[model samples]
Target: MRLFLVSQLLLVFISVLALTRAQTAPPTTTDTATTETSTAQPTPTDTATTTQAIAIATTTAWTAPPIFYPFGSAAGDTEQFENGGDTYRDVAFSTPFMFFGRMYNNTYVNNNGLLTFNQPLPEAHPYPFPTHGSEDFIAPLWTELDDIGIGRYSYQQYTNGSVLTRASQEINQYFPHKGFSASWVFVATWDYVQTSDVNVLNLHSAPAITFQVVLISGGGYSFILMNYGDCAATYYPVEAGYDTISSTDYHVIHYAFDGSYIPNLKNTSNVNVPGRWAFLVNNGTETENVIGVQLKLSSFLDLTLNENIEDVLQKIKQELVNRGASSFFEMKLRNVETDKEKNVAGRETFELITLT
Candidate 1:
């Protein structure tokens, strides 16, 4: 009985040990699986953090602002104008004639047609009409009226048998003693007058006449006019691109007047004045029109025209590399002056810098 009891106790101890070992082994497997899942999750987190860093880098890149320079003065300077007189006529008839007036009274017309108060009339002409016939007699009077001042001039003529009646407009001054002067002259006539009708009914009228005088400096002048009424808007088409330093990615792009390229002067055609440069931006697959800024010609030539064109391209490549944009982005230089062949000083090549 004692032996049997001792054997039973040993068996019981062995069974308890086996049970404990089985429980401990499952926990080891569970711990290993949990560690593997934690490691795998951290890898995704690292990838997400990397993506966020890239986004931040791209957003912070510097882009240049648009710059605009007007032809005459700094942007937003008010234009000046001056008015001299109204109607004072020594009447005549027949022939086309020009009216003259004092801008700065008693002023002389400079080589540029600018008037200085102390100078003499620079140019003179016999009134536009001849001093002959019934119509010719009245022409000088109209010329005299035009020379008296700066303003729009209108004339009317009436005839009864051989008698002709004439009238002209008086000057209405708005801008006084300003730097600019302008004038307009209109002439019209009828073929004949009826025996009893004082009112001229049938008349053939010429187009209205208009002219302007802009004094730039002491001797500079600009005379402008629009003879015809029909005017149309101007348009320009442009293509641009950039290339990588290693000649990796070269992109070619085009834009129309009404498309992505927005010009500063929307109403007029590009004048292509000397010393003007433009900047363009990438708008996804389509690039924005060369409208971001107007870099001065001096600045562009200084920055872009040094050394060989190829060398400049390499410099652009270096810039990309310094910015840490080497692996994924590239630029190819495209020719920008081809469309402006007449304005090109020489056969210079333009480069396109593209990002891949």
Candidate 2:
């Protein structure tokens, strides 16, 4: 009986030892698997972090906004010549009038009435006169035409109230060897009366005649003219008033003229007959004058004028200034015509405006 009891105890002790060994062996395998899993997870996480960092570093920077410079006025002071005054003329004669560094007069008029070839007006006879009627008629003068280096030449004549002929001349020799191209405005300030006779005659004319820049050659020549008449007869003759004209690309050349005549020509003699015109080389710049806001520049890209374009231009100008552009590169403003007629009962103002 004692031997049997001892055997049972020995068997129980062996079973306990086997159970302990089995439980401890599983723990060892589990620990190894946990370590492997942790290590594998970190590799993918690290790779993802590295990729995210690279993408952030490669992002592009933002572009700055554009800017705008004004060409006209915003407020009051009736007599002042500054932009905002009531009587202030929004006419721009020449702004930044530069071509290859030298400043050339952009306002030119080629009427045969005002100048005798090569002869600038005597200081006394500044105003233009008719070419034919008066024996005293002076040949029209041109300061720069003889010196123009390149371009074709042409001439037209008006006779008996009609266009008589057009002629072309190969006068390259007459032009200057090298000169910067420019634009100009032509103005005619006159008082016309409906004569009892069939033919129209000038009752009392204050004709301010000038010539324009006509391109004979090269890709960038444009001529423009604007005439603003003060009396009713003058305005009615041309059907001139508020009007807007456009061109293809801003760089494309275009020519236009505007004129207006006031009623009761005698009463408004003091009121000036103002004209506005411009010539742009290489690129055409657009300007707008609003009553309340600063002047705006239109985009040259599409050459389409829009209400908000001015705002965008202003932003662009600000950005360019921030980017270190000089004030000379900044846009300029000008008033071309300001002189008032002295002889007329009512003041008649005439100007040749240009905006560079």
Please tell me which predicted candidate would have the highest lDDT against the true structure. 1
Q: lDDT of each prediction vs. the true structure?
A: 0.27, 0.26
Give one digit per residue, the lDDT tens place, for model 2 in 68-148: 011112211111111111111122233323331223333222221121212233222222121112122112121121121
Q: Where is model 2 poorest over a 10-residue stretch in terms of lDDT?
A: 63-72
Candidate 1, residue 315: Cα displacement in angstroms equals: 52
Please, what are the lDDT tens digits per residue for candidate 1 over residues 106-218? 22222211122332322322222111222101110111212322222222222221111111111112112323222222222111111122121111122111211211111
Minimal lDDT window, size 10, model 1: 163-172
Candidate 2, residue 38: how far the Cα is off, in Å: 5.0
